[model samples]
Target: MNVSVSRNSSHSEPRSLLAGVLAVLVHLIFVAMLIFGLNWKDHPPEGMVVDIWTELPQPTREPVKTVPSKQEPKPVQEPVKPKTEPPKPEPPQSELPPEPVKSEPPKPAAPQKAVTTPPVKKPDIALKQKPEPIKEEKPDLQEQKKKEQEKVKEQEKLKELEKQKELEKKKELEKQKELEKKKALEKQKELEKQKELDKQKELEKQKELQKQKEKEQAIQRQREQEAKAQREAEAQRAAQQAAARNLVTNEVSKYKALILAKIRSRIVMPPDLPGNPVAEFNVTLLPGGDILDVRLSKSSGHAAFDSAVERAIFLSKPLPLPPDPALFGEFRNLNIKVHYRE
Candidate 1:
C-alpha cells in the first residue's frame, strides 16, 4: 500500500523523522551490546533496561570581535653618519707588556685563643688544723687480730647463755621428778592403809563367826539334853517367832506405831570416835545364822571406829526374816549398815 504524498507535506518530511529514529536506534544498539556482552551471562533471561541519561555540553556563544589597541609610531630616526677617521692600530701580541702585577702579602696563620681550663678551688683536706699523717689500713695484720678477739668473746658469751639455759632445764626436770615421786609415795600409803583395814575386818569377822558357832553348839547341846516334848515346844516357839516378824512387817504400815517404839528401845547409841568420819556399808546374809561375808564399801578415816562398825555388822548376822513371802523379802538378807551417833 504505497501512499505517495505531495512535496512539502508533513508525512513526506523524512529528515526530522529520520534523525529521531536514528537517536532511538543508537540507544537500542548500545543497550543490546551491553546485554549481549558485558552483562549477558550474569543476567541471562531478563532484558535489563538501563536509562543512561547524560548531560550534554552547553552551547557556547561565539566571542565578539574586539578593536586592537593602536601603538604610537616610533620617532623616525636618521641613520647616524660614520666618522671618517683612520682606525687605531692593535698592539702586537709578542710586544705587549705583562699585565700589571697584583700585590699580595703572605697570610699569617689565625691566632688561637688560650685553651687552658681555670684551676678549681680544692676541698679542705686538713683535719681541724692538725697535720696528722694518714694511717694506712692494717688490712692484713691488725684487723685480723681484732676480728679474732671479737669472735672469741662472742663464742664465750654464747657458751655461757647455753650453759645457763641447760641448768634451768635440768632444774625443771628435777622438780618434775620430785613431784612424781611424792605422788607415788602418797599412792603407796593409801594402798597400805587399805590393806591394814582389810586385815582388821577379816580378823573381826573370824572372831564373830567363832563366837556364833560356840553359842549355836551350846544351844544344840542344851536341846539334846531336853526331852522330846520340850524339844517340840522349843521348835514351836522358834516357829512362832519366825511368823511374828512376818506378821509385824506384813502389816507394818498398820503396826508402824508399835515397831518404831520397839526398834528405838533396842537401838544403842555407840560412843563417838575422834574424826568426823562416816562409813557407808552393805551386806547380804544367808538363812543360817552364819555371816557369809562382810563388805566395807566406804571407809571412815578412823581405824578403830571402822573396825568397830564392821564387828557390829558381823555380830548381827542372819537377820530375822518374815514368815510370809509377801513380807519375807522386806529384810531378807538385804542392805544394812551399823548406824551409831554420839
Candidate 2:
C-alpha cells in the first residue's frame, strides 16, 4: 500500500517541457520563412534624359541711288545816255544886260533850233554746288548660343536631387520592419520562462504533502504496539498471584493439625465423667504463635471435665504455625472442637 501511494505521488506530467520545445520550433520556422519569402535583388533607379532645340535670327539689307551736279548763269549790265550842250550860256552874262533890252525880238529868233538826249545799258556774272553719300549697320550671333546652354544644365541638376530623395525614403522603411521583429522574439522567450517556473512550484508542493502523510502513518503503528504489550503484562501478574494463594492455604491446614495434637497430649480426664464429651473452643494468638485468649463456645456439661480441658489449653501456649509469615493472619483467631472418649 505504501509503495503504490509513493509511486502515484512521485510521477508528474511533462507538459511544460513539451511546450518549451514547441515554442522553439515555431520560432525557427518563422526565421526560415523570412529568409526565403523576401525579395533581395538589387535594382538601381533609371536616369532621365532631356533634349532642347532653338532657332537663330536672320539679317536684313537696303538699296543705293546716284545724284546729278549741273547749274545756270546770270545776265549783263546796260549802257549810259548822252546830254545836249547848254546853249551857249555863258559868255555872256556881262553883256546880257544889253541883250534883255532886246528880248522880244530874240525869242522869235530861238524857235528856229530845238535840242534832244540819248538811252543807257546793264552787266552779268556765272557760279555752281555738289551732293553727299549714305551708310549701313549689322547684328551678333555667339552671345545667343551661350544663354541656351546654361538653361539646359540647370534643368539636369534639379532632376538629380529628386532621385536622391526617393532612395532615402526606401531605406527608412526597411529599418522599421527589422526593429519590430526583434521585439516579438523577446516577448516569446519571457512567456516560456514563466511557464517553467510554475511547473517547478507545483512539483515541490506535492513532495511536501507526501512527507506529512508518511509521518502520521509511522506514529499510528507505534501506538498500537505499546497497547498490546500492556495487556499481556496484566494477564501474567494475575496467574502468579493465584498460585501463591493456593500454596498458603495448604500449609495452614497442616499446621492446624499439629496444634490440635499438642493440646490433646496435655489433657487429663476424670474417670467418672459420663459419655463421650465434645467441647468447642475459640483461640486468639499473636503473630509469633503465643496464645492471647481462649474461650469455650460449647461446654461438656460436667464442671470437672470442662476444668480439665481449660487447663490443657493453657498448658499448650505458643501453638505451632505455618512456615510462611504471609499465612499467619488466617491462623491468628481460630475455632476448634475437641472430642474425649473414656
Off by over 4 Å in 1: 1-151, 218-342
List the pairs of residues colliding in candidate 2: 75-124, 76-122, 76-123, 76-124, 77-122, 77-123, 78-121, 78-122, 79-120, 79-121
Per-residue lDDT over 1-342 for candidate 2, one digit per residue giving the tens place of the 0 to 100 score: 999999998887669898999999999999988876664533444564544522111110010011001110110001001101121342252235345323533443343221100100100110011011111121123223323433443453344334334433443443344334434543443454444445444443543454344444444544555566777767767776676766766777788888888888888877866678888789998988888888988988877777787788889877888777878888988886777872
Which numbered prediction scores highest in TM-score against the true structure?
A: 2
Error of 1 at 249 (Å): 59
RMSD in Å for model 1 = 63.9
Q: Which ten residues in a row have the lowest lDDT in candidate 1?
A: 111-120
Model 2 regions more than 4 Å off:
1-219, 269-277, 302-305
Residue 109 CA displacement from its true place in model 1, Å: 99
The residue-level lDDT of candidate 2 at 265 comes to 82
Summed backbone clashes in each candidate are 0, 10
